[model samples]
Target: MDKKITNYIIYAVFIVLLFLSTLFKSFSTDVLWPKDQNAKGSFDGIIFSDPQDISGLNVTRTIFKENNKNLVKYDVSFLYEGDFGNLRILGNPVSQIFLPNKMNPVFSDVTLKGEYNKINNALFQENLKLKDLYKKVPDHEFSTTSKIRVPLDKEVPEVKFSMLYEPRQITHGLKGNIAQNAVFVTNARVESFRDTTKQEKGIKNESKNFQESGYYVNSIEVINEKQIKSISFESTLNSIVFIISLATAILLIWLDKNKSQVPLLISMMLSIMTVSRFLDKGATTFGILFIWTITGYLASLLSYAITSEENKIKTRDFKRSIAWTLIFLLVNIIVFIIPRTF
Candidate 1:
């Protein structure tokens, strides 16, 4: 076999192997990026009986820890059609209140207020009072503002909001075998509203009911910027080590192709690979080092095969190359597949 042809074969094999290894490296898990900036969960907008009457709605939330407990405060604003005075807003006691920890029964408090504004009929009704329009005709819009505070036991990575409605009831009763003391109960009657004739006659005769309503701003993510940066830095370090190992392997193999320098160059390559494995125990770094070690050994064996004058020595080098190639394949399988599978 001509020495020039052998040299080309070795270089071509090395280049192909290196290219394939790098292609695999591109898909390795060591590459890192920001993964915490997005929220994950089902977040249907706030529920309403009628969804079309609402012009717009906005909800903004702020989360923080207070008194050893995580708390989220929500500020909500929405525009609706109809008279603000006659709108009766009621929240479902069960679903409207959110608890961070399910064990606690305390319900969060919610407050709401609405402001009135006249629409197109304001010019003709400029002298008319708002109180007089209660029964005449609906010609106004209202902007509502609301706030809610929810308590949580721990910080949530993401938040999902939904509206739920269900029937609930409470009852109290006691039973005992022993005699019990007698108990007495009392009841009181209260009168709430009374209207005067002048007020009733001056009021406009119009329906003041809400026609429709809707909700928006359903989900948000709580991101940890510091943790994302740490992951990115670690990935960058791993990539740098991989690049350095690849370059070193190519240089060492090219140097080892010379007959006189084979022993010294192979020894140096082995020593460097061993030291690198110890320095960085990461799978990516180890895999690169293992690949370079195999290539170095193969290059040394090929050098011996071509340079030796005796037929027996050349045959021995050929057999050794076959054995080393098999061993390299087995080690690569274990390194690349085992860790990723489990």
Candidate 2:
């Protein structure tokens, strides 16, 4: 019934909310990257298939293959499932192959390979700049697209392809009988010794009006090796961020308990920035970083407003404050950790 008690209750509720936010924001990162290990590899070639003709039948397929190899060559081959009928739907195909980049094992052949080390050094310098940018930017803003090129020739003789059986339960009419599997081919090269264009000639002979496969050959590039480091604090300076956040939290909790608002507000702001480190994993667009930063500040603002409206600090009041705080803490725990369990 006392005004001081009521104020303490409200202050306790907001402080508890802050703790809950801190504890559960990590869950968003989990949702962004699956823990099941479903994604095939950390480094691999990219394979794509499009029912829609967005890449232009042959040109897109060639571009896709080249990018796959240039970025990294997977031990397995890549495949594209073309829709024989429709020619407009264009998007990244299902299944991603992660292979090593050309710079891996970090050693070059002793024999002269025409300034291979110099070229690699230049590339490494460029990669360093990119990595720096990646750290400064929030995780949500990272790009997902991969661009590569692979040379098709004698040494790289056989093209390998992989296919998955689409059960009739889901795609009955589209994929038809289970006996016929979707086919994807990799490492396809036109033989130099044989009549390489024989298939085109045959198709033309049958139709009396046939054109080359409508796919043009572009220059091929190969990625000899590549690397993907584990998700860690080394790159993001996360340890620094974490230290700053914890210090800020402790300092604010102390200052507010002693009846000082300024230090508390400053501490809250720092904690918000600290949490922003994890946002890197989920953002799809550049604008997401801005959004997250704004949300962090907004949370801090709400904390300030709630405390100001309620004059007495929770630490000063004890019992009623603890009860009120527990309600919020319980709610956040239920919302974040409980539902997924069921």
Candidate number with greatest lDDT: 1
Determine which window of 10 residues in candidate 1 has minimal summed lDDT. Answer: 177-186
Off by over 4 Å in 1: 1-8, 11-44, 47-52, 55-58, 64-221, 252-342
Model 1 lDDT tens row, 1-342: 754455446545644554444444422322211112111111111333233433344444343345653333433334434221112222332235443333133333333421122211231243212323111122222222222333222233122333232211111011001110100000111111111111122222111111111121121223223333443465466556545654554554454344543443344333323333233222343454465556556554644543443312365666776565565455555654464544
Give me the runs in candidate 2 sitting further than 4 Å from their true place.
1-27, 30-38, 41-231, 234-236, 257-263, 276-294, 302-342
TM per candidate:
0.32, 0.28
Top candidate (TM-score):
1
